[model samples]
Target: MKIILSPAKKMITDTDSITPDGLPEFIDKTTEIQKWLKSKSKEELKTIWKCNDKIAEQNFNRLENMDLYHLLTPAVLSYEGIAFQYMAPSVFEDSQFEYVQNHLRILSAFYGVLKPRDGVTPYRLEMQVKVGIGETKNLYEYWGDLFIAENSIENPEDIKGFKRLGYAFRPDLSSEIEYIFERKIETMTR
Candidate 1:
C-alpha cells in the first residue's frame, strides 16, 4: 500500500529534528536536472520559474549554491505547506513514523519519488514546470509513468487508509489501473 503526495512549494531546512533515512532513489537523475538548471541564466530561470525578481533571485542563488548531498532534512519535515503543516509529522509517534515510511511517497520533479525520511535539500521545481531536459519538452513527458508505477497499489487492504482520511472509494470512477477516492465537500469543510 502506498499513499502518493505532491511536494510543497514552500520548504525549510530542518536538520535538527529527525535524521534522513537516505538520499532519494533517483539522485543521479536529479543531478542531471540540476546541471541543466545551472546552465540557464538568472533571467532565463526567472522566465522558467514564472516569478518576480525577488523570488527568482532567491531560487537562482539556491541553484548556484545547491548541494544535493549535504545538510539534508527528512522529506516529511522539509515542506511547510498547509498539507504538510496539517500532517504534523513532528508530533508523530514511532509507529506512525514507521507506517508513513512504508506507505507514503512524495513525488518530486527535482528528486523523483521520495520516501518519508529521504534526505532532501530545498529546491523550487514543480511537476508542471516546462523545461527542456534531455529530449523531453516538459516534466510530464520526462516523468511519464514512472511515478504511477512507483505508487501503484497491489493489495486490497490499501484501500482502507483512504477511508480513514474521509475518502470513500468510488467504484464507479475506478478501473483496474486507477483507484479514485472522493471526499464530500461537507466532510472536507469539517
Candidate 2:
C-alpha cells in the first residue's frame, strides 16, 4: 500500500537526530537531470526555474554544487510544507516511522521518485517543471513510462478536490489533478 505524494518547494537541511536509512531508487536518473541543469548558465536556469534573481542564484549555486552521494538527509525529514509539517515525522514513533518507510513515496522533478527514507539533498524542482534530457521535451516525456512500468500501483485516487457525496467520495470531473491520478490508475489497471 504505497501512497504517492508531491514534493514541496520549501525544504530544510537538518538530520540532527536521524540517520538516513535508504538510498534513492532513481539516483542515476536524478544525476542525469542534475548534469543537464549544471550545464546551463545561471540565467538559463533562472528562466527554467521561473524564479526571482535571489532564488535563481541560490538554486543555481545548489545545482552547481549538487552531489548525489554526499550531504544527504532522509526525504521524510528533508521537506517542509503543509502536509509534511502536519506529518511531523520528527515525533513519529519507531513503528510509525517504519510504516512511513514502507508505505510512502514522493514524486519529484529532480529525484524522479523517492521513498520516505531515501537520502536526498535540498533542491527546488517541481514535478510539473519542464526539463528536456536528450530528445525528451519535458519531465513527463523524460520519465516516459518509467514510473508506471516500475511500480505496482493498484489504485490511484486523488482526494485533492473530491467531495463526500453523502457517504461516498466521488470523483470531480473538472479536477485535472484528480484526472491525472485516475488516469494513471486506469492505465495501470488495464
Best by lDDT: 1
Writing each residue's lDDT as its tens digit, candidate 2 over 76-183 gives 998997679989998989998899988988877788778888889889875455666887767855764566454444444423332211122334553544232222
Model 2 residue runs over 4 Å out of place are 150-190
What clash count does candidate 1 reach? 0
Cα lDDT tens digits, model 1, 1-190, are: 8787778888899999989998998899899899999999998888888889998988999889999999999999998877789999999899999999999988788998899999999998875577788887767557655643544746655643445333476888978755556655444553
Top model number, TM-score: 1
Q: Rate the local accuracy (lDDT) of all candidates.
A: 0.82, 0.73
State every prediction's TM-score relative to the real structure: 0.78, 0.77
List CA RMSD, all candidates.
Answer: 6.4, 8.4
